[model samples]
Target: MTQINRRDFIKLTGASAALVAVPSVLKAEIGSAYEARVVVVGGGFAGATLAKYLCLWGDANIQVTMIDKNPNHVSCILSNLILNDRLNMNDITLPYTSLQDNYGVIVRQGLVTDVTGDDVKIVHLDDGDTITCDYVVLAPGIEFIDVPGLKEGAANNFDVVPHAWIAGPQTELLRDQLHSMQQGDTFVMTVPQSPYRCPPGPYERACVVADYIKRVNDGDGHVIVLDPHPEVTIEKETFEQAFNGIYKDIVNYVPNATLQSIEINPGEKIAKTTAGDYAGKVLNVIPTHKSGKIVEDLGLLPVGARFAPVDSASYESTIRPGIFIIGDANDSGQPKSGHMANSQAKVGADAIIRMIASKSSSVDFVHDPARLEKIRTNSACYSPITYDEASFLTAVFAYETTNNSMKLVQDSFASSNSPHWNKDNFEDMFIWSESLFSNSFT
Candidate 1:
């Protein structure tokens, strides 16, 4: 790991001189006198990253509190592999104890029933306690969009077709269905519309599941993908190439096909789709999504009712002051992924630190306007396609300071055949998970 100096960090900002400021250290006693409390909602990738970075980089004058409904988080990033049995759910599930023990962050297991700019009130199911904070970070993840017939199925015939997008029981139900399928039976996968979490996740699931079926069922099973998007962003060519060249006999890819309704035949143990009535032994439906219900209940989203609009520069909600939204919940052009969410959290943390520092009288005289101007830009690096099971293509985008339009700096494909993909990438993931857990719960 390279040590990130303040100068290098500033350069990464892409901001003008107006944003950079000298790092200051305050005595513990002085810091405690005016410590600002930060409350983070949702313990997923974005919320956890922001909370961790704030405690790691911000002044000691800041106290962090993280609130979440679940005590442990199972990452959606790698959950697709779990469906194929490539990875177990334990590999992605992380507890909050590490965050509490390591970072000294106050972690409360509660649901944020309501949120305002200055204070957030959470309802603790364990003991019915309400906790409030000064600054709140909202990263409650996303809620599935109610596709009319889809909800009807979920309420009634959930055993036949399952939307395993959310972790826990839904995931296990889908996995069990796949395991129970006959060797020659068909399996159907439906990809949701754009702006969903992990653009390549559905495709990845298809690949991994196909690989599993080929290995176990001796290439007797068939897998079909129904994509709502006209084309996939990641590995479109490569995926087509693989499907045509290697998995041609077993895998079928259909694009621009919207799934209107799901007709489950319990007698035949099959599912029907909009393209045609195809019988399948198992069905996995990835539905359209919006900001989670908690966020909607808190009235954080805009009039569109899709995502919460925020200033791209700060990730601060336009509708609510002092409340920041990151990850899939925010209406940013960036693809919703754990990697992008982590990057945005760092930027949000830095902005909050700058905002807090600007209020101090001692820093007023020494504040350099030139440096402050330089701290406004943020960038994101996304790995959209995984070439094989190991590596893929990535896009690096930088946000313009004035307009916030994303500029592609590097959009190229890369392969990682080395064992380091598992070694280094897994290590990085654990570090990220630990940091988030600590920040949110400690």
Candidate 2:
């Protein structure tokens, strides 16, 4: 096997092509004995990356405490491989040891109950522990909206219809269920409304499951996809080809199948929706997602909005200047993917360092003309259409002074052609995903 490194990843991801990296070390240089504390609320791709870079780029005065419910983060990126048996939980599990040992970031394992304060922030934990800080970043990722009939089903039985979206024990349950498929058994899955965590994720899951079933059953099992959207969400042509061309006999793609309720039973599950009731041996129903619980509990979300709105240049909450939201929680009009979250963390980290380095605790520094021009972010993701074939997409966005928001650069947008889905791209997917996992966590 060929060895791939982070340098190769930067070139493939193309985030550096738009100059997204800002030198926070420069911010560290101009500070005296001024000390600042940053408390990050979650330790996924967004919060962990912010905490690690804050200590690495900021001066010794930068003290960061990361509070997460778990000591390790199981990445949703490359998790599809787990269903196909190419990878396992250990491969995607990232610990906080490096952040603590190498960068001096304090990793606190607890659930954040409430966050209060204006100039200074106080993070309240469920265990009655509170951490005071100069700035607080909310990167709790996402939470799912309850389906009409899921609560009762879950109460009666555990994980009857496993979504496996967050990628942990639920993921293992879903995989084990897939492994139990008989020769003619059926697997049914749903795609929630748009603006969910990952745009291409549902379709990718369908393909991976179909591929696995074909291999084990010799093309006897059936795979059904129920998507509410009009058509494919992202990389339309590529996924359409995979569904219709490669796995047509085993896969069935149904559009505009709005999910209404679900009925769980001992041997089979049925999804009741506008399209019709689908009876299958296994069910994976991913509900519509919203910002993390903390964002909604703290009243950061605007009226009738699912996510919190923030200034794209710095990712600082418009509702609360000193409080920042990154990853799937923020409404920045960016794709909610791991690569994008890592990029947004860099922008947020740089802005926070600059604020403290100025020797002023005021939050108005984000409006400076020079600071806005330096704002740029990019995202790249590779989706596996089969167990050994993949497709990819890349996009770059820069802060537009006219709109006061980030806009996609038409020239920088690129996606792999449907015809290019081959073995080479499949190999690149593992390298790309592994590199991203290492770069953000390690």
Candidate 2's residue-wise lDDT over 274-363, tens digit each? Answer: 899998999999888889989989989988898899988778888877899998999999888888888898888877887887866554
Q: Candidate 2 at residue 224, lDDT?
A: 91
Query: In candidate 1, where is summed lDDT lowest over 10 consecutive residues?
Result: 378-387
Off by over 4 Å in 1: 1-33, 116-128, 152-160, 267-274, 360-388, 410-442
Best-fitting candidate, scored by lDDT: 2
> Per-residue lDDT for 82 in model 2?
91
Candidate that scores best on TM-score: 2
lDDT (Cα, tens digit) per residue for candidate 1, span 210-300: 7777777888898888887777656565566656756788889887777777765663433344566555778787877888777787687
RMSD of each: 6.4, 3.5
Task: Give the Å error, residue 186, model 2.
Answer: 0.9
Supply the TM-score for candidate 2: 0.93
Each model's C-alpha lDDT? 0.63, 0.82
lDDT of model number 1: 0.63
What clash count goes with each model? 26, 0
After TM-score superposition, the amount by which residue 41's alpha carbon in candidate 2 deviates from its true location, in angstroms, is: 0.7
TM-score of each: 0.79, 0.93
Residue runs of model 2 more than 4 Å from their true location after superposition: 1-21, 152-158, 361-363
